[model samples]
Target: MKLNSIISERWSPVAFSKKVPDDDTIQLLFRAASRAPSSFNAQPWKFIYGIKDVDTMYGYLFDLINDSNQKWVKTAPMLALGIVETVPPGRTSLNRFAWYDTGMSVGNLLAQATDMGLYVHQMGGYDHEKARKVLNLSNVHEPAAMIAIGYKGDPDQLPREIAERENKRQGRKSVSEFVTKNPF
Candidate 1:
């Protein structure tokens, strides 16, 4: 897909078909993530996908979700937890760049999903501490975020609150408000 098309056409999808991603498809998504840029190549990301135990994953997230998000996420088939090691590097502080790098991977993954005709919804409205316990996750690979992926579906079937959001056209902040000509 062209850069502009991908940027403009892609949107987070909350309504997913019940179809779960096969191992090969999930691996392809991970492979796309692997190509994402990382700080100094420390490459701190480690991902965990929930397929067979999707219920557990959903329960885990359902418990952790920021109340605002739970209403919509009730239906996705696959959930990917983004993790990153935060140990300090030589003479430097903790790997602050881990999440940043992982976020890049998420961008790549989402874009790839878009290319593959799948849909993804990236979320931060989740409880990190509980996520650690349910997934047997550790602070080592800090659970930065979770993403839901699956086939797109009719938004009307979603919970009313999220269904409203799904119908609205997504937009970005004005470049004029965010871009700069030089160092601030």
Candidate 2:
């Protein structure tokens, strides 16, 4: 079976080139993300981005990342935090679909980035509490993931152990393992 090239070629990489995406490309990436469907169109996804070496926001985001991810993520020309508003606007109840919708938004972002010859590495390793404090996020806004964005770069630039892991083909389980017509 054949998959779309954009889906097949997309991957998370530890190495990223020094090139920085210009303003238009940055806007387009988020525009694609904004297009993602959401329950009741709450559109709770919000992104905070920082261009490396261009602003203090980058340093603030970098400081939130754990040491393990910082080693390689630092090379990326841009960084971003994916945030979700847990409660739908003007409602006190939790929006159960908030996280799921946020993931779809990021999925749109990944596809758009891949089609544009850029790459994105979504990371869950971050200081969640610190992110809230540093970004001055409101109680409703929750940081979901930190993202590294840039062109794919030389794996040799990564740590020896990580470099060895970088090129390995990641495998997915067969349909039989997870899919079934019967209700669980």
Candidate 3:
């Protein structure tokens, strides 16, 4: 699909089908992320997926997500925790752009999912420490956020409070609001 079309259609999907996504689908999602560009090719982003019932420890990370997310998240058959490792490959130092790299990878993942008739909701209201234990992750892989994926489901499945918020039209700041022609 065209980049503009993809961007226009991409929204944080709050409801997802109960059916779990297939392995091939998951592979493609990560593959898209793998292609994201990074500073010095450091390739600092890493993803740990907890597929279906296979994630016996899912509850650890699952519980960390905000209560607001719990309603719809329970219906999603797949939850992905996207993380970023320490900046740079050789040095134990920080690179300010590592988070940017990870964010781009997530954008790739979301677009790929959308291309496959799937939906993704990126959320930051989660507990990173709990995710670390559930996924058995090391410090090198820090939890950046969680993404719930699947096909879109009935809007009725959401609570009235949530449903109301979901139905509201979303708005964005015009390019004029943030774009500037002059140097600071």
Candidate 4:
């Protein structure tokens, strides 16, 4: 069976080129993400991004990453922090689906990036509190994940262990494994 090109083409890579995406391209990515649907149109997703050489923001985001991710993520041309506003605007109650909605936004961003010949790798291995502190964020905003974005690079240039993994073909579980008829 065939799948959508954007869906099939998207893959997270530990190796990334040092060439930064242009401002227009980055804006396009954010535009796509902004179009994602949200509960009650809350649009709780937020992104903090930085391009290498544009400012010191990249280093600030990089510092929040764990040592392991830092090993390969340094070469990425752009970095972003995904966050969710747990509290809806002008409301006190928590939005239980905030994180889920944020993930959908990221999905939109990733699809747009893939269509544009860019690659994105989202990592959960980061210091969440550090990111919050670095960004000077309030409690209402919760860090979701860190994203490394750039063109794909030579996996051979990666560290031995990472290179080994990058060289292997990726596999996913069959739909049958996760789908069910009706029973919970």
Candidate 5:
């Protein structure tokens, strides 16, 4: 089946190069994410990112990752946390679709990064409360996911098990399994 180059080419790589992406490229990613549609245009997504060569940000974020993820994610040149505001500014009720909107924003970010020859690996394996404290996030914000972004690196550099998985081609469920034309 045919697919758009940006969509087809995007894959989450466990190994990443050490080269930090420039500030302009990073901002471009946020710009793409900002364009995603949201419930009532609330745009609840927010990101906290750190480049490897920068200050202590990378280390602090890295430490919050679970042990399994920490093994490989440290090699990534950039790290970010996706956050969603449970209650949007100037609103009284909870934003029911906040997490869904945040995921859409991340989708845009992934596509944009792929178009720029970068790869992104997003993980749910992190300490949420720890992230909240470290980032000084208010009670209104929820930690959604952690993202490791950088250029793809040599799979051989990864640990044996991870390398094997990374080198293998991934598969997806057939469309028939998930798509439906009428109510079941």
Candidate 6:
């Protein structure tokens, strides 16, 4: 079976164009994410975003990213931090699925981006503790990932090794390799 073009074509590229998506477009991305299902409809995901040359938060988010990622991320036009609300409002117990739910939301965001001819790269190599301190993340909130968003850029502009890596096709495990029948 063939996969949908959007899904098949989706990839995380380190080389991003300088073009900045408009405010409406950015908001639309979040709207798509908002449509994702969540535990008890708690909608635990929260995103903090900033556009390059337009918002100071962009720099702060960029600074939080590790040096290696920073090299190519600098070309992206926007950056965002994905955060999850660990506890539901008025509740003390932990929401075990908060992280998973947040990831679902981000998945929706990525699909929307691909449909709109944009690219998104989610990064785990960021200063998590510093992010908590700098962003003033509350006790109930925890950082999940940092995202770089923009159009695809010229690979030639990236460092040689990174450019090569960016040009490589993304590979995934076959369904049969990970799937199992009931009563396994």
Query: Highest lDDT, which number?
Result: 6
Q: How well is each residue in 39-70 modelled by candidate 1, as lDDT tens digits?
A: 88887787776653545555655567777776
> How do the residues 6-107 of candidate 4 rate in per-residue lDDT, one tens digit apiece?
998798888888778999999999999999999998999999988887869998998889999998998899999999999998899999999999999999
In model 3, the clashing pairs are none
lDDT of 2: 0.94
Model 1, TM vs. native: 0.85
Query: Candidate 2 lDDT, tens digit per residue, 97-158?
Result: 99999999999999999999999999999999999999999999999999999998998988
Residue 161 lDDT in model 4? 97
Write down the worst ten-residue block by lDDT for model 5: 161-170
Candidate ranking (lDDT, best to worst): 6, 2, 4, 5, 3, 1
All-Cα superposition RMSD per candidate: 2.7, 1.0, 2.2, 1.1, 1.3, 1.1
Question: TM per model?
Answer: 0.85, 0.96, 0.89, 0.96, 0.95, 0.96
lDDT of each: 0.77, 0.94, 0.80, 0.92, 0.91, 0.94
Q: Clashing pairs in model 1?
A: none
Give the residue spans of candidate 5 off by over 4 A: none
Residue lDDT tens for model 6, 3-92:
899888899998998899998899999999999999898899999999999999999999999999998898999999999999999999
TM-score of 3: 0.89
lDDT of 5 by residue, 18-126 (tens): 7788889999999999999999999999998888878588888899999999988978999999999999898788999999999999999999999999999999999
Look at candidate 4 and give me any clashing residue pairs: none
Candidate 2 local Cα displacement, residue 37, angstroms: 0.4
Against the true structure, candidate 5 has what lDDT?
0.91
| Per-residue accuracy of model 3 over 28-140 as CA lDDT, tens digit each | 99999999998888778987667667685456557778887887787777888888886565677787788889999998998898888888887888877777776787666
Stretches of model 6 off by over 4 angstroms after superposition = 182-184
Candidate 2 Cα misplacement greater than 4 A, ranges: none
The reply for model 3, stretches above 4 Å from the true place, is 1-3, 133-136
- Which is the winner by TM-score between candidate 4 and candidate 5? 4
